[model samples]
Target: MPDIVSKSRSGTLGPAPAARTPRRHTVAVLAFPGISPFHLSVPSLVFGRIGAGGAEASPYRVVICAERPGTLSTPAGFDIVVPAGLEALDGADTVVVPSWERDMPLPEPVRAALRRAHADGARIVGLCLGAWAIAASGLADGREVTTHWSAAAELARAHPAVRVRADTLWSDDGDVITSAGVAAALDCCLHLVRKDHGSRAATELARRLVLAPHRSGSQAQYIPVAVPEALDNDPLEQAMVWARTHLDDPLDLDTWARTALMSRRTFTRRFRDRTGSSPQQWLLHQRVDHARLLLESTDDTMDRIAADTGLGTAVNLRHHFHRLLGTSPAAHRMLFRHPAA
Candidate 1:
């Protein structure tokens, strides 16, 4: 059995296989003028508000607050009247700044509130460009952080005091968490849910949202994609679908590149540019991801899973699995294996 660390890039790892929180916690999200509705909604949705759907009441108390108590317009040309003001931060256990539009100024009061919230020990999160607001708060000074990859250079330039990482889905530095872009915010918030609540709750919520339960920040932020010369005929997309269907068979760089009808060099470059990894790494990740699903959802033997996922042998499977996930396949299976029906 492999030892499980109490921490990972996803969040704090709980020792109990399916540990639940002992108490409910409050999550407060910040709303600001000119913010996109999508950014404002990701935290609320992932913290278990929107997809609760007859499930047990979520263990989180979610609140959305703004600088003032009134209507605010979003970039989508819509308006929403937030229910609370900055004072709402007083009771929050976690405060999320979902995103920050570059032109929108971080008002001093908002910055003060974020500082006070962190001083009071609330976990602070800045998804996407919201990291800018977190930086403006000055708490992240001298801390490693990240934002949308496109803005990473500018963020570093603007806040040289803060170390900016450009290539991650999210960064978990204890109290301050930041994510790369729009989709990565979902991963970040789900990570928080898993940390606070547990794997069971997070898995249930992920099932509802149709999201993968875990994606380490070590994965690249940008994946290379090729045009394939046809808008409707995406060779890379088609190759990915084909690869999934053929996971049980031998797969190699030349085979995958051939499936896309591109030279191996072009395929490798495009794969990295779009998916943030080379073809080999992507194939290995997909194999591990598939094997995990098999471990959780099926009673298949180790050899079966290894064979089905194209790892070729159990030793190879265990070696790659433990390398990527930090836990043995048998141990991971024990944690996530489905209960008898």
Candidate 2:
């Protein structure tokens, strides 16, 4: 079926008074039979916060629910008791399906519940193979989503209407968000915190959990190892290493090809085949990525960052950074900068 789904509606809220109680957003995590303990804990670990005084300090309330509301066995040779049934999703601000079993048929009740949640304006998240659950519900039919790279082909084959982006670590389509795999699930959930609360809040939370503050969703999810051994002589790998070191210098197709000891045409073909992008495109992305790191971790000026990254001027840096990452350099630093103090 060529699946087209309905859009979710959103409401605006007014500002609260200083002394007002914190508004708690309810998060519902769904568990099913044979679910992984790690996948099931991702959401809870991300959202639940404990205060220094041992009180619940988070602005989110997380709950676990199952279709049958009973003990479910895990592949890790343990069991978890779920106290709430599908009814737990009723008042949830967000509904998360951590992961779904491979090739398992979607239950009709679960599908209907998901559809109802979406219709009621709740955000839906599918971590890893959980995207299969969302796809089966018809909510993600025409949406661009992602899942584990190994299962991406199967997801595309099963739900041809959903655009499966296997390259990205995650995909956020407004109300519907999906992630690539296990660790990517943490990245996606942390991304959700950043989206809802703000970068500073997400950064503090990530520090508490000892996780990377932010990994851009656009980063490649599954890059193959460039070399099997340190001593292995690979021209392409050598060229890439040289390029990384020489990013502050002006580089072009000819220079890169020469570095690899190959002609321009051959270099272009091999580069595209190996990296899935043209040399020019790859170089630009690398420069911008370096710029991002400089912005986040250093006190460099725009001009300095641009010069250091081989981007020439501040104007050129802003133009390319905004074009690629949808934000200005200054703003990125403001959101992500961590002072050494």
Candidate 3:
């Protein structure tokens, strides 16, 4: 058995009462065999750091716990000594499982502890490959989740009950939260903070960490194609480059087909085959992307932005912006506008 040391809650909020009362949040990170140091460090770095300038700033208490209390070697050749064991999980309001190596199996005791924590109303988080451990624990059955793209297929194949969406950065099912790859873990953690504390607290933590406070889970993980190398004779690549720069202009099937020197039907077929979306859909994505940049980087009026992006009018812009971004143009600007102050 490992020695469990319970520290009095630090920062503001203090300790909890025996009866029902609000208290400081306890976050326990499970440091298992062959865990990535980068994955293990993220929660501690984000939740452990105290915010400057506030009486209400009660930082989360982060504890690294393991099945056994001792030093464990990381995949990177470094060693970390964790003094607390699975018993420490009893006090946690949230339990985090960081990335583990591919071949490692989650120990049975750890799995039981995680299940118990969830049963007792503690939120569970699985970051990166840690999703595999959570799935193995049988806690994520019938719940939607995601992991790194490379591991998503295997996780889905291995556990048919878990709904796995490979493309998204994260998914939240109330008590159980799962995130995709490395950087996306930060997004998920901040999301939890936002849920518990509010957007202002989460945004403050993100600002202190110098990261984007929020990125939509639905954003494409990677751009569709490699930047086409300059080819002296490649007209298709040239047309693509031209279309990107001229996104503000009215671009229709006829216009693009003429530019690409093909019939409209043939152009539509070829564009779909190459880009995995119809030419019109691709153009809409480009326009939305351009509008997003403008919203973040400039204070342009909605009407001017709409005309500039070829969306025809502010109403049209708002329609597409809401459809694609899940928020209006002005709301998007408020969340992502150039930081002033």
TM-score of each: 0.70, 0.75, 0.66
Residue 280 error for model 3, in Å?
6.7
Error of 2 at 62 (Å): 1.3
The digit string of per-residue lDDT tens for model 1 on 133-226 reads: 9988898999988788889889999889999988667887889999888889999898777656556667878888899887653435354334
Q: What would the per-residue lDDT of candidate 3 be over residues 1-341, giving only the tens digit for each residue?
A: 65444446664554344565456689999997677899999888777763664424455778899999799988898899999999989969999998765567778898899999999989999999889988888999998887886788889998899988776678878788899889889888887776566556667878888988777533242425543466655555566777888877887778778887889888787666665567787778778767876776678988888888888789999999887655888876776543322
TM-score, candidate number 3:
0.66
1-341: candidate 2 lDDT, tens digit per residue: 54444443444444332466777899999999999999999999888852222227777889999999989999999899999999988868999999998779899989988889898889999999999999999999889898998888899999999999787778888899999999999999998887676666777778888898866534342556353365448788889889989999999889889988999999998887777677888888889989988886779999999999999999999999998766889887876654321
Question: Where's the lowest-lDDT run of ten residues in candidate 3?
Answer: 217-226
Clashing pairs in 1: 222-276, 223-273, 223-274, 223-275, 223-276, 224-272, 224-273, 224-274, 224-275
Report model 1's TM-score to 2 decimal places: 0.70
Query: Best by TM-score, which number?
Result: 2
Angstrom error of the Cα, residue 94, model 2: value is 1.6
Candidates ranked by TM-score:
2, 1, 3
Clashing pairs in 3: none
Off by over 4 Å in 2: 1-18, 49-55, 216-226, 231-248, 253-279, 291-341
Question: Each prediction's Cα lDDT score?
Answer: 0.82, 0.85, 0.79
